[model samples]
Target chain A: MQDKPFMSSLTTDEVATSLRRKGRWGLGEVLFWLAAAATLFFLPERHLILNEIAIIGLFAVSLDLILGYAGIVSLGHAAFFGVGAYVAGIFAKEMTGDPLTGLAVAGVAAALLGFATSFLVLRGADLTRLMVTLGVALVAGEIANQASWLTGGADGLQGIMMGPLLGMFEFDIFGTTAYAYSLVVLFVLFVVARRIVHSPFGLSLRSIRDNSLRARAVGIPVNRRLVAIYTISAAYAGIAGGLLAQTTQFVSLDVLAFHRSADVLLVLVIGGVGYLYGGLIGAVIFKVLQDILSSMTPQYWQFWIGLILVVLVLAGRERLTERARFLAGRLFGRSAGAPRTAPAREGRP
Target chain B: MTPALETIGLQKRFGGLTATDNVSFRLEKGARHALIGPNGAGKTTFINLLTGVIPPTSGRILLEGADITRLCPELRVQRGLARTFQINQLFPAMTPLETLGLAVSERKGSGRDWWRVFGSDREIVDEVVGIAQRFRLADVLDERTSNLPYGKQRLLEIAVAFACEPRVLLLDEPAAGVPEAERHELLATVAALPRDVSVLLIEHDMDLVFSFAERISVLVNGGLFTEGTVDEIAADPRVRAVYLGESVDE
Candidate 1:
């Protein structure tokens, strides 16, 4: 046995050193939150677009929690999204119109489904997990279609009336209230997620993702952690779906559609993975690009979107960010170390 | 008295081949034991069975008198069984600091706390730093494990096992690929391990096995051929026959 360490294992100096190295709120984080808040004042005309971005951003964040952090590839995240939408829609119409209660109900319903299905994911590799998840979404979509009375079948669930958020600020025609409400929900959940991803549990998830056998050898409960994170991510997706149902007062079969799941995956890849802001940034770019391309070409918009995804994939997210930084330097005449504030993506390729 | 670890009637048959055939062994508390065999003698297979990597065909594994034959690998580790891989299995992307910190945190049951920031956990950070220093990994603690030198990577592998505060440590080829210059340091570290933790070292190097292990077990054809102290094994005619190119029949 080697001699004990010099510090006598007392933990005084080491603790001090650790505390000193502790990461606090960096300038980039502050700036990112500030910009998100500033959107309310600067983008009044695009409230609907911003509201859509917030909802999709939440969905992408949920995917990142499982896919990027936990290394669980899910192809049918829309299952939870659709579950939340239908549950919230049904709850508001049949029971209470209170938005928060509806959101809670939606999250719980989706989380239960996620917890039940998590066992399937725990047994397989990436491809198997993908197929299982996609199958789940397909099954869920069928259920929604077949159960016409509760889910309104193919036409979708309509006549959802959400009471004012906090019983004060009513949802509006221009989506102003919806934007603020969604942004607040997004911000609160983002904080919770940010806290989670930086904590010891978050670090353990990354370790498991990197090497699960070693993780198991080291006494990390690999299966339990995966199941926990998967369930939480499902709840997050459910909340995003609930936001959509509440904001629009309409729930459709598209809530559980394959396109919804596929779109979120595309958004995450475009923005980047493992990083919290990847989903938010990806949703913004995905929605904005969709908006512009659909208006311009209408029929061929998907082609343009596909082209952008291919370009992003080929260039690599890190390389594109580097090139963007270089171009920005050339354009703005700013030096390399000019306190550049990017959201916390960590930029690992 | 109960041995620290014991395997009773342990047998593993892969199809028709008996990789380990009814091999029973005992390791006393604080005993420095070595399991050495020629190529294909199932040294690694035995270690795998002990560490819960693979289930034995028919046997019982007892840790301090409690049967742990059916426990999962992680549960085994939690029960104080730790092993370093024959091949380096450190996480490639994580720095030594992060890897060690994670292991320590898990040991302390803070592994699932999503609210506590890792850097702020002084006790864990301190323990990790101390382990890194003891393993001579202080300078490269911040460097990725994959980028570290091979010898250093081997040391880090041991360091990670130590982070678990294990009662039984299975060291498989601790100095297999280490360079000649670093071999002394590696052996010295192994030699100096605290006596409270019993060590079962699986090594092919005769010099290391003779010097480090208080008792040695020789395995031939997936079965225990002989067992004795360093001197007794050295002088035994049967042991000599196995090593000196003489068949047991002869």
Candidate 2:
């Protein structure tokens, strides 16, 4: 047996290098984004579906920020999404129609609501959080339904006219511009979220998630961190909702519906949680499955989706991913070996 | 100088049972103190009250002469009070590196910086590495914490608390479940803790308590039974009857 050193002799630079390497963007990440961008030219005819996927993907990512990292179970996430949708729609109709400005306004509005409701989440366990979140969404939907003059009530907010993307690209009927706009917004926010989860702040959040008692023992202000992440997640969801409003040129009561919250949770489950990319990956699979199944059986498409969910849950995500990695490693050989272990251990950053 | 940690007339009652009964305790600055009592003697309860895990029924806790009875647990930690639990309260999913990083970063007030990557700060990395080495966890720093040996996990429990840079450290039975071979490392590390940091050790191991503590406080039935030096406690027959007599038989 080799003798162990009394102290680590590793230089600061070496330690820093190893630490930075953990957060480095891997080739898989680059390839994933490249494929997303390639959809613009390769899948132009499917831009409408692509636009929807981008918006929902962003929404799923927002939920992942709170549920995945902070372990805050929010069932009323759609409350923020709905708020963003209405705020952007109104801002475009009554204020300036600039898509970027509308998105900003909507995000701020959702963040405010998130900040206010964040305290409610701090007081409860998982069950309480779920109830509170669900309650918030229900209340939001009812307000949108009753406030007919302002929100168009159950009729839905209509005639939302959005200005060009960056004062240039118009939102066309084919959704080419809308897809591009949503994709960019998703990418930017994804980068920010990525940065957060990789940071010390993010590390503290994971600690809080794993064991709040120890987190507090170590001086992590658990409640404050939860509130911060919830607010930021609210902003992300709001932006995603704003994207939907801008791209579709309409806001509906369904945006704040309970189904929206459940659907986002389903998306996270499909993609896996804690890791950021699960939402994006889950969104792609969910939206595509919805599109294909809906075409085949428009009335009973949800039955097939539910079936898939059951299979996915019963089979277990970790086992399935391991199997996928084994197959990919066999196909690609040595190149996939290192990357597999990296993500398997840490879950992808 | 004020006591590093002081509990004035601390009392805790769980319904009809009095867990801790009106006890005033002080851990002097830079002192090596041991708090020993048999199981159910309310040693853990006293530590819990000091750390603000559960509020005392009626009492005032002071850290460095400032009243901290109403302060929350994390606030106490922030005020340079740190502790290890009787049962390890570690993040099972995190590695030792990440655990130390969290502790150190939080101490340096960078735990809230969401925009900056955790290891991007050179100082934090250096300190984490330093703490890992000091605690003999350098080799297994990257390994998941749950998979670590019972001894290393205990070391990590101390290492994380040490990383908080606390003025007073409460170690609750650090050697409880450690096997014989690993006890040396655990004890040596405990002995080698910085002198400037006051240590209050709570242990059932008479050997560790006797060797490590300059001053000892004994508790019985949730109240202070006796206080003395090592030799004085060793000679006290009442202490032996209430506590050490059972340990000697074991």
Best by DockQ: 2
lDDT by residue for model 2 (A95-179), tens: 9999999999999999999999999999878899999999999999999999999999988899988889899988899999999
lDDT, candidate 2, B1-250, per-residue tens: 7999998999999999999998999899999999998889999899989999899999899999999999999999999999998899998888888899999999999999988877999889888988888899987888889999999999999999999999999999999899999999999989889889999999999899988999999999899999999999999999999999888877
Best by TM-score: 2
| DockQ list for all candidates | 0.52, 0.61
Q: Across residues B148-168, which tens digit of lDDT does each residue of candidate 1 receive? A: 988889999999998999899
lDDT of each: 0.86, 0.90
Please, what is the TM-score per model? Answer: 0.93, 0.96
- Range of the 10 consecutive residues with the lowest summed lDDT in candidate 2 chain A: A340-349
Q: For model 1, what is the error of residue B232's alpha carbon versus the real structure, in angstroms, after optimal superposition?
A: 2.8
TM-score of chain B of each: 0.95, 0.98
